[model samples]
Target chain A: MQEKDIFNLLTDEGFCNYCLKTNADDVEYWENWLEEHPSERENIESQKNLIILLANETAAQVTQSEYQKLQRRIQLSKKNNRKIFPLIMRWAVAASLIISLSFGYYFYHKAQNNRQIATTISNKTAPGSTKAILILANGQKIELSAAANGTIATQSNTAIRKTNDGRIIYDGDSKSLLYNTTITPRGGKFDLTLADGTKVTLDAASSIKYPVSFTGKERKVEITGQVYFEVAHNAAKPFRVLTRGQTIEVLGTHFNINAYDDEPTIKTTLLEGKVSVNYLGINALLKPGEQASVKSGVSDIRVKAVDTELVIAWKNGLFRFSKTGLRSVMRQISRWYDMEIIYPETLKNTDLFEGSTPRSANVQSILRKLEVTGHVKFKVDGNKIIILNK
Target chain B: MKKGLDYINEWDAFVQAENEAAFHELYCHYFKYLSFIALKKGFPVNKVKDNINDLFLCLWEKKGQLNNVVNFHNYIVSSFLRKLYRKENLEIDESMFVETVPGLQTYPSVESQYIAQHTQDDLSRILKIFVEKLPDKQKQMIYQKFYLGLSYKEISETNSISINTVYNTIYKALEKLKIEIGKENLSAFSLALALLSLLCLIYFQKIS
Candidate 1:
């Protein structure tokens, strides 16, 4: 056999398979054939050498940035883990507070102790609500009522429609030109519409500034709080949302933007269509079912696969909690119920939750359901929800 | 407590309890060669770094539970390849959404069958790199044979190439590779090569 023939046989799956199976006769035959081809000996040696070279290459090295990121993630994970204990302790304290206040109220009323009754009433009163200021582009302050509902304004020929559904919509001509801003308190939720007919549902303690009409080449909006957007289709005019340190630009898509000022990262989740997420100097093109998060001053964006429904469950009128902590859960409750959350430091540390409740349901009902799960217990007196040890 | 100690210890633990420093030393010593392999395999610089980091992390995480890993470098290479495959699969899933969502309008499931773990050892990486550098026809032939693990008959059928040409190209590729690495330590090189060849044989034999 020629050197080429031997090489071919070595590369062939059948020959390799035969060799692997330890077919003595085939090996003998190949060896004999190679012995007879003296001219091809050099070529055979080279083939052997090449095989060795191919086998010796090592694994790739990790980059410094990746190492740093991993280190940071480890640190953050540790920090989060540490915080879990404190949150639990806080829950314990809150539970004690609830018990004392309830007993005090009962004793004071039963004894007709007027002085004690006043002090106990003051102690049991709900914590202060989150105060938010809405600064309109026209320099006007709208002190939004906790019970405010319906259309707030008409700008740039578009109606700034706020629905009872806790959403805002901009319904008007695509050519109309006006912009408005809406701000929400920590314990509040609001909805808005964009000029180009995009519906935005802002989570508690969030704010957004958007024009009444998308008259320019692109529909752009600035956001500060968490907002879910169902963008209207206009391929000619791409929709762009700027939040904190990241920018998401999409051409007719559905997505959610969570750029809360206090959060360490700006997360953009693409529900449908293509979006280019620009953060930390990197432009990552994202598709549906993908989420990208950018940290402040970090040039790298972390991309991960996620379920879109889980991210936008708030807009769907369901408080779909997935592996969230008690503090996060309370934060969401405080917004919708418009109540303050005060707890001992330890209660803040516990972070496992998975439940769903209708947004329209009263706070007491929601807490009762949570109690059934045995993961959490709550005491409700009027608008305040006291976290209890489960 | 040190910057590189954790990684070194992890690597040492993979080989033997006290040998983690050796693993770290090897990792740092051969960083360039490993990077070359990653680059040749089409991994961007950033991703290559991540791949290696993940490999070290995995080693550390699985240290106490690991069995004897034959040929540590080959094992690392295989792990890296699997990471690259996973990353690529994710990208493909993401791209599928973009292509089919609006204009194409096909509700293709984002899931792919290629999500399975693939461990192509060091030899395979070297072979892939060499084959990629070959001329179009040569590269295709090598890919069909080695990468695709095709038989001579299959290669002949796929590209209408004579069995003789298939053999010749494989011979030439092996010879070129041997010459390139011949300058290094001969005995250690030979052992590594032989081990790799055996590994490839076992891998493809199972697949085929």
Candidate 2:
């Protein structure tokens, strides 16, 4: 093959080991071919780099309104940055360390911030893109990210189709009652409509285990990480989300759950409907625009009025932090950006950040934002970002 | 060409919140430079906006530590570059040496250089033409694979197409780029075309 043929293959995206998902045969052939022509190795590698160069160059120019939107978000963050770390904020920090739940939902600033950060992969884990893995009831795993859209699989009595906008839809009878689990990896997100028209948006490093057909008396789905659910209303059949340490029952509602194990608390925020959160032996009813916090070692769940907009901002692609601690903020960043956060003794436990930036942004952009607060400094080294003393 | 010290000094001034004007000035000054870099790097417009915005936010968040930064420009640029690379690029020095091997047809340098040096406006104009010319399905496919970096399988599932179709669509688009870069036998002619495209891009960008 000509060197250009090799170039063509390298630029083809899935032709190398870096592609992550490759045909074993193609990998074998290329492995052998490169070995035979040792000299072509250098050229092949350069071609691969050239494709990256192309990919890097493909970033679109920023628009006027988008810039203005970020400007607003920054200013708002600046306002929050000055927050005095009052009792509520401290409580939030304490709660976050124990679980993912913090009633500390930053209030909706009511500011119009439509900042959208384009996902960049050069440093750290790229922000979650539209990808999900679907595990069938039979334990057959379908890489939903790669399958053909329509009816990729028929689990039990449900037909699963990936929509053009990258949503998985379940359409069919609920007679089978077989369970299917959808999981989003560390840097992935996907929109899902369950067997009963319930819309669920799974955030990065999250999963939802739901029955393909909800045949029983109640609709139950278990979740880990953060998931924004807009449950389809049915008076006869209530939707219940079984999360770590708690169970949330809703007649029909919109809510979000942050249930990652590393978080010190479990936060479930109700947006547009009435929901009841049961944690340990205690139960708390939540009204619209309220958040329930289930703190570690605490038997009761605390419910409070919250700005639903701020709590569910991830669904809209914004990272909204209000009086959020450095650690808490970085926790969100590390999960979304898929980077390990290394802190020097200085930033390990100092400062509170307040603001909103799009999760689609490059890690550096966000890091720079934090650095300018004058309380923190950052250095991005490969996939790990080290926090240095100023 | 301001020195890194000057940039750091300005960063300090802005971080201290002693001079909002200095902050705005710094933003205006680096906005174009970063935009040019990002646009030249082929980031789309809204992202260019977000990239700059996010950097500024980072500056604000880490302002307390601005005094520690020795090279603000390199710091910012490296940070932005970090956003682009999931893995390290092969050493260019090695490739540069390999390119000089006698009779080896290095994939035309004219295109690579031209590609890397485009201004935001120039790229926007060219992409407008290029993307508009593509069939809707192909355009969507290109955006999904190149912009979103979705796997072919993800794209196939999303677009309701076969995995081969997804691969072929991207393969064809990239092939067009290869052909465009390979059209002429004479290096001088290809260089001339690249320059001509640059000129046309600049001219078209100015008018539009």
Candidate 3:
């Protein structure tokens, strides 16, 4: 390489590759190349250094705000092993561990303590079941959960039936398209397959209204409460989900929409493919492993990379929460158990719980886990729970 | 109570054990440097802040691997910056706003020496002078190449110039830079190299 052309070579692909450190082979080649051609070394060296300086200059100034945010994210991500029990309970668990320590040992102690107090003696309500009410286009209400598997109903030309696994599947293509609404009560949850092969799992107290046969360029579904969608891709057709204050559009993707009316924010977490979350006038796109949170009374949309596992834990039958407040945790419990929650009048506690238990666990078992926190106690009376100070 | 080196030494152990207190101290110690580096990588202010947390999360996930990690501070700095860049690229999602980068080249390996004596404020001050001294065309080329992390091909097409011309433009800018900064202060370029390695570290992380 000529002296003048050294700069050109440096700015070229190979030189950039070297700086970016593509491989050991590239680095070795450049080192030997420089040694062999020492005449152009000085000029090449200077240009190389300049590239480094320029790269350094790319980063802008940092702010205190930035540091604080980083700290919060780190804390959020480190929650895998967080028990979140109160300090007193934590010490008790620690002492037990010192005496008989295995991961299962501590869990065994908890299971025994919860069973002794919760499931056997306490008024117990089981978690939600595979139950839903199907409203036909003609306003006929069919209790799908009570009916045996096989052909439950035929909407237009589509056979609306339950699989062996109890999931509703729309098997046949319906030429005459009519809308059907499936609703799950407070103590129920159900999964259904749409005409376009889209699979939706509706949570308790949620409903989805969709057409028996999808037509036109867009497949539209209106939903309330929480639902998980595995949208079947139709390149020419798009899938749009409408909720209270937001609309999510996707070509074909796996996503979870938590738009429960009780929650302030409508969170749409994408697990695969792409989804566009449109709220108010703004549009925020999401990739796999990213979540778009649309808040009430706010037009601005916030996007963040999140643990997809944590977001979809409900669908997987786990009550996975991170630093969740007692109030919110109890809210979820109420929906799952078809129970009402009442708190003491003189509430002065601010402690939040930060752990998860099986959703299928009895109400007493669930409450016992919270009680172990040593912050709040639960009195399960019939289908109502009274929360009080410890 | 451990300051500087003492904190750095215990960082891995504290993180491994999920010791929030010890980790909080470490976060405060390195927060400023990491924040500055993220900004330099062309992240928006909100994202710069978010990436700081993402970096820690990424660190927490790989806490067990910290036992094998050498050059801890450099690893943290480069990874922190890289985390910001990766989040933007990887999480473009379904938003219609982002134009996906075609074949984005990753930055080099994060070597320990990447961040050195100069603070964020110091680096910014010097770079501002250098940018001010350069001509408009040279400044644009430098901005496109360095700040944007654009390839020569992309820069060429974006600017509607020949590929060689893109090289020449950057070369001329560097010549001007060496002349203006002088041979005596040549060590500054090496300092920049250390910083640039943060990008490289991110790039390597992407492939691996």
Q: Best TM-score goes to which candidate? A: 3
TM-score of 1: 0.40
Chain A TM-scores, all candidates?
0.57, 0.68, 0.68
Best by lDDT: 3
Instruction: Give the distance in Å from residue A311's predicted Cα in candidate 1 to where it truly belongs.
Output: 1.3
TM-score of each: 0.40, 0.46, 0.48
Query: Which parts of model 2 are misplaced by more than 4 Å?
Result: A1-125, A346-349, B1-208
Compute the lDDT for candidate 3: 0.68
Alpha-carbon local distance difference test for all models: 0.57, 0.64, 0.68
How do the residues B23-120 of candidate 2 rate in per-residue lDDT, one tens digit apiece?
Answer: 66567555644544444334554555566787777876777777765445546654654443322341111000000111111222354445455433
Q: Write the per-residue lDDT of candidate 1 for residues B54-131, one digit (tens) a residue.
A: 666666555656566533443554455556667665211110000001111011112111111122244445445554
Pitting candidate 1 against candidate 2, the one with the higher lDDT is 2
lDDT of 3 by residue, B24-48 (tens): 6666555544433343333454465
Candidate 1 vs candidate 3, lDDT winner: 3
What lDDT tens digits, residue by residue, belong to model 3 across residues A89-183? 77988898787767588889889888867656644487788899999999999998888889988866789878898988887777776899999
**Residue A189 displacement (Å), model 3:** 1.4
DockQ of 3: 0.07
The CAPRI category of model 1 is incorrect
lDDT of 3 at A272: 95
